[model samples]
Target: MMKLGFDGKVALVTGAGSGIGAAVSRQLAEEGAEVVVADLNGDAAQTVAAEIRSLGGQAQHIAVDVSDPDAVERLVQFVIDRCGALHLAVNNAGTDGVRKATADYPLDEWHKLLNVNLNGVFYCMKHEIAAMVQNGGGSIVNMSSILGCVGLPTASAYTAAKHGVVGLTKVAAIEYARMGVRINAVGPGWIETPLLLDHSDTVSTRRMVALQPMARRGTPQEVSALVCFLLSEQASFISGSYHLVDGAYTAH
Candidate 1:
């Protein structure tokens, strides 16, 4: 129930097609931000954007693969061209690579995973920061995973990529602090999202839930609450920090 104001702000959320990304997009729009919903799935993006519009909010949709640098450049330009200015962003586009041991991970999957999960964030920040600087100042929330802070069995590639995201976020935050851009990472644990459902079975999910102190899965809306705060004036003094919405999974 802690609604923050984002009136007149233009915000971009990558991977806005579903889950946390979609949740973030909707909340931002409801809070008075003109949201640009970007995702690899054009249909899903359109759907989310349309939902916001139906709810009496302003929104637009775009399809772009963040893993592609050239595409990312175009994405930023698109935002500027359509929105007139870019003041906020959430680099939430990412993939959960197959769970495999380091020694058994496939080379191609590793590269692909890194491309979207890690390099993609860098590419987004590179362009987003430039635009934000021109706009005077802005805030960004990068979606990292609980894996970013700790290791998980059979998840070498994902853990590595997420860890890289945390490091990248910190570096960019420091470099842009004086430029009026604040960057931070969010680490979510066992969120009930497509990424989780697609990769986890009943037994596996239950087992994971059992490990949580909350004894249940976190919702995408829960994660969005933190994301929206980070991109708002409420978190003006918060930057270069890694935040967790993990239900105390790491408490142990």
Candidate 2:
């Protein structure tokens, strides 16, 4: 296996306050990349950045609502102004939305879910792509879910938004391939995140685990490993693809 490194690279990871996002930020920093830990929760973002600094890694925190296009644009600009270039990005900010059947799903809730999970990724990608192009090239990893490829009861909105991410990733990857930008989507299974752990006893959680061939939930570090690889030169020829870290959850 080839050892990967992000020496002198600049990376931006949204939702970096916790879970897979935080793990990715740390991993990138460990690999010598100057990382930006971005999240809507300012304090959480700052905490993560502080942790990275303590580990002797270069990192900073930025607070922004990814659902807002203006905020997304400003995020890119802030990175450039501070770091001088934007080379790697992981659009990991997302929400699970309200759990309800499609017919019973609240209208406002649907819009809210899509705005962050789907539109948020789009907004980030739009500005990130422009910046990457100007910098000559870069890589992006959009966080999707195994739900993106399969349906789940009472998760209609979340499912739809994730599916949309996979589609959007494909289109963006193709359009930007010639320009040297490689964009891809990552479909994670039921990772052991705080959000999932909080619902560990729920029927939905049990069902999710049973579907996985591994018969257990994955970890944030596991997903982060894949995201970092996709963002590195080791995956040079990989683009416009949806890589799943779901422990064969969808194998059936």
lDDT (tens digit, per residue) of candidate 2 on 1-252: 455679999999999999999999999999999999999998999999999999999999999999998999999999999999999999999888778888999999999999999999999999999999999999999999998899999999999999999999999999999999999999999899976877778798787787778878899999999999999999999999999998888888
When summed lDDT is taken over every stretch of 10 residues in candidate 2, the lowest stretch is: 193-202
For residues 57-138, could you state the per-residue lDDT of candidate 1 as single tens digits?
A: 9999999999999999999999999999999999999988777778999999999999999999999999999999999999
Evaluated against the true structure, the overall lDDT of model 2 is 0.94
State TM-scores per candidate: 0.97, 0.98
lDDT of 1: 0.94
What's the lDDT for all of these models?
0.94, 0.94
Give stretches of model 1 more than 4 Å off: 202-206
CA RMSD, predictions in order: 1.1, 1.0
